[model samples]
Target: MSSSKKARTHPQYELLYWPGKMPGRGEFIRLVFEAAGVSYRDVSNEEENGMKIILDMISPESTGDSDSNPPVFAPPALRIPGEGKDGKALLIYQTPSILSYLGDRLGLAGEDEAEKAWVLSHALTALDLNNEAHDTHHPIAVAEFYEDQKEESLKKAKNFREVRIPKFLGFFERVLKGNEKQGEGKYLVGSKLSFADTTVWHVLNGLQFAFPKELGSRKKEFPTLFETFYQSVQEQSRLKEYLASDRRFPFSQGIYRYYPELDRQ
Candidate 1:
């Protein structure tokens, strides 16, 4: 039995995130689980005291015990109960790290060492794009409200729309073209669907939601590589159903906020 296959032992998986309608970083992890047909409890929505649960886990008090696990700095953490070293709970945090770990376990990272490295590299790049998109609306500081930094956000948004978006999209397009030349199939890293493809799809989806007008106008520049890749992911039966279902949260004040003032063509 392969390790990846063995990892899917039907262990109790719980995702800890903010309880809201908006899909923040948690959505990326959700997509992987959904696509792999792995069932997990979304504690943020299902549990009555999900937020409190997360707080207690990350609190200083929780880490005082010699047997207690290390603290996770933020939300979108995955908790595998009784699966850690010495029978402790295993908590994985950070969007990229969590997704990469899940990808490896779910056979979405890649088949070999070189392909796995490429997948990680591309996934990190997608994360970079996601962060940049989020910063468009919260340029000054995450602690401050969007209204508090509207002026700075406008400048940042303009620069992002004019410069950063194109650079990232263009790089992906080139990657797609290169992959095609190498006969690696339509997916990003290899002929098969990998986590890198899913991460890129999420970033593109977020971009379209945040800057529909701008992305629409620039659609002709990158050819159909990215669009096709995104459509391919959407067509996956499990993911398609998840996307249309209520389980998939809509974009609002989250990372991909659509502010008319910040949007441009």
Candidate 2:
């Protein structure tokens, strides 16, 4: 389907996030829209004065919008026009919540109740890894600069590479192995693609970029996850096109960051 057709079919979904090249948590939402081939407005990236729009939405004094929705705590909020009460736009935040809602709408949740449960379970697990990765760089305090916490970061990153990485990757490899009868090591829950697969793929991609040496050395241990699942998720038609296009941003100072000292020796 073409862009125009997608625009007409799906709601004019607006994604509000920090306006920059960093993927952050917003990238998870972007991956979903891309994989589903849906049209959405990346408010911070595409709109003029997008930064102000985000600030205003998350402002401390703000209570709630005219849409009757609650106040947003942060960015990566989704606004769906006419979805709220009295035909007003609905605003929602939180990455996992947004993914869950969109997953159901985009047919990426799962085929049944059981599969849906597993999809969310696996996605949440992947997000846990994402959070751990962020902490590796900001071990002491999130507000402090990485340079100030370099000593602690080194310790955090070392343990992350040696212990946490293998633990998370091993879990996913087992998931793929258990579902291989249906998923063929490609899908996490059912036969088709789900948000869970996309979620895990992004984390692994970030890890590979953030700690290339650490991941490269361990790839052979998790063949199903690295060799099959990771490669297959990115090659999905719509995701592949989006990744190759300018819409996708490379990891930098966001949740994933490459620090030479923090990686394997």
Question: Which candidate's TM-score is highest?
Answer: 2
- List the pairs of residues colliding in candidate 2: none
Give the least accurate 10-residue stretch of model 2, judged by summed lDDT: 1-10
The lDDT of each candidate is: 0.82, 0.92
lDDT of 2 at 33: 92
What is the TM-score (0 to 1) of candidate 1?
0.91
The predictions' CA RMSDs to the true structure, in order, are: 3.8, 1.4
lDDT of 2: 0.92
lDDT of 1 by residue, 189-249 (tens): 8787788887888889989999999998998887745566667888888889889988889
Instruction: List the candidate 2 regions with Cα displacement exceeding 4 Å.
Output: 1-7
Q: Candidate 2 lDDT, tens digit per residue, 1-265? A: 2245543777888888999867999999999999999888888788889899999999999999878999999878999998888899989999999999999999999999999999999999999999999999999899889999999999999999999999999999999999999999998897999999999999999999999999999999999999999999999989999999888998889999999999999
- Candidate with best lDDT: 2
